[model samples]
Target: MSVSLNGVGLTHANGQVALSGIDLQVSSGERVAIIGPSGAGKTSLLRLLASNLRPTAGQVSLLEQQPWQLSARQRQHLRARIGLIHQAPPLPPRQRVVTAVLAGKLGQWSLVKSLLNLLHPVDMSGAAAALARLDLADKLFERCDQLSGGQLQRVGIARVLYQAPELILADEPVSAMDPVLAGHTLSVLNEEASRRGMTLLASLHAVDLALTHFPRVIGVREGRIVFDQPPATISPAQLDALYANEQLQVLPAPESTTQASVQIPRC
Candidate 1:
């Protein structure tokens, strides 16, 4: 599967332009990262690609289906095929972790089964296994409200794993975690997505993490794409220049040169 955007632009309800004349394509199994300052329209771009927003002009296509062309049912079907991870994991606080993870399978399951599982959570084994992949097996029965922010993020990932979508859209999936946990979480995501040959598109504030984790990187500024390159090809100076105008904080230099400690803007 693939996603293509041609001359696509988005303007807010109050006439604030968020994206302008964007043209890009994401192919199956490609891992792409979007990086930029806050309010640079990073989220807007993802929303456009995910078909959550209609372009004010031009076209947005996923696979062979046009975003505006598809029927409501078809759009839902297409969306169900893509997995999304938000910057802040938003699971129901009162729900069990296992039940939250099981919700990922709702798109494929029958309505009766979904309702039945919601009440009793019959397929705890699958949810438990998915959690195990993220080293959260013990938290299966824990309430979502009790899990740490990092733990909640892992649960979100576990849901995506269980859903097994063809495309994974992760918006700073580990921004709230410490560096060690962030690397581990991203590694798990990359490994799982690679195994399934799924396309992974992520929007991240961590320049270093984007460079370290993603093969291809796209930069946005004022709703315009400024840079799109491979990690190795992009220099630190270039990154610094990219966010020079924004008020930001650089991470403390890394302990070792062997590990990437690319500074990210605090925004």
Candidate 2:
């Protein structure tokens, strides 16, 4: 399936245009990274694809279904086929990690079964397996509220991993973690998405991370997609254009000028 956004624009309640005249496409099994400075509308783009927000103009389609045209039931069905990892892991605070992971299966399970799980809590074996994959097995029975930022994000990923959606949309999924954990999490996500042949589109702030993991990269600036190209082929000049003042500060400044200019590999 393909996620296509054509001339899509989104506006905020305060009359700010979050995204405008954007045209992008993600084919099945393509791992794309959207990279840009802060306030570049990365989250906005993700919301559009996830159908959490309707486009102010133009069209957004996933698997050939127009999001707004679908009935409530049909929308839910379509949403079930798409997995999203928010920048902040939004799990129920008091819910156990296993329960949070099991929430992923609610779409596939019957309503009665969903309600029953809410009460008795079942199917933890799969959650345990996913936790093991992320080296979070020890935290399975722990409450989501008690976990650290990184742990909460892992719990979120575990849920999506179990859901096995055809499309995965991640917005700064590793922003809260240290370099080591961030790399580990992203590697696991990218590997699993590849193994399952699912399309993965992730928004990222780390330039090298996106360059290292994703073959294709899209650069957003001021709510517009400024550049879309292969990571390896993207020039520093193009990066400078996208980030401008922001890029000079973040990118390797030149070996002679300052000690911080050196490139440090991060997770």
Candidate 3:
């Protein structure tokens, strides 16, 4: 198995409970999509699974090892085997895209090699190939500040592809993309995960995209999991209940034909 969470929960130092009583298990090569309304603890759950945030309750076992129980150095080594894709990648404004992509291997590279690569990106071809998969090959030499939000997101994904970790955790990865581009980009991501047999878990606001791309879907609300089932078995009512806060904005409609236009939240 790739990961197991036994009654996992997280509470901030300020006494804010981000998640509680969550239980999830995923095996190697499984691709699961997490769907939820904003502030529903999706980000917290992914972060917790990635070992970026420790749980306040329950146990988390990832890549067959308990992260909290491991020594700091051991934990650092464990992190090298995982790839995290942020919704908004924090690339330095002055950094080149090639440098940013090559930085993905810094955890595995020797210190001297890392320093040399920083000076003049050693794996330009490798970085270019990763970018090409996302239709950003031409931007290899571009500066981070010169790209738009969607382009930056692709760059972030390119970095992960270059990293080729055992597990992939993405949080709202395609939020900035146009509908067509979003669909295409997700296809690219899913294809890569399948090809490499990487365990993939992503949290997405686009429910249709979640259903179309992932075989398994988990819905979360109020810091708790509402449902975890195969996409074909998930009913419209369950999805409705998961996003049932009348006070909040309703989720958007399916943006493109690539996404199945069925059973979505509405005002």
Give the candidate number with the greatest lDDT.
3
Give the TM-score of each candidate: 0.93, 0.91, 0.93
Looking at model 3, how many pairs of residues clash? Answer: 0
Of the pair 2 and 3, which is ahead by lDDT?
3
Better of 1 and 3 by lDDT: 3
Worst ten in a row by lDDT for model 1: 252-261
Instruction: Name every residue pair that clashes in candidate 2.
Output: 179-267, 183-267
Model 1, residue 150: C-alpha shift (Å): 1.2
Stretches of candidate 2 off by over 4 Å are 247-267
Model 3 / residue 20 / CA error / Å: 1.5
- Candidates arranged by lDDT, highest first: 3, 1, 2
lDDT of 1 by residue, 1-267 (tens): 578888989998999999998999888889998998888999998888788998998888886688689889989998888888987777899999999999998998899999999889978899999999999999999999998888999999999999999988888788778988898888889989999998899998877778778888898988988888887776556667678777667564333222334557873
Report the candidate with higher TM-score, 2 versus 3.
3
Report, for every candidate in turn, its global Cα lDDT versus the true structure. 0.85, 0.85, 0.90
Candidate 3: misplaced stretches above 4 Å? 246-267
Clashing pairs in 3: none
Q: Which stretches of candidate 1 lie over 4 Å from their true place?
A: 248-263
RMSD in angstroms between candidate 3 and the native structure over all alpha carbons: 2.8
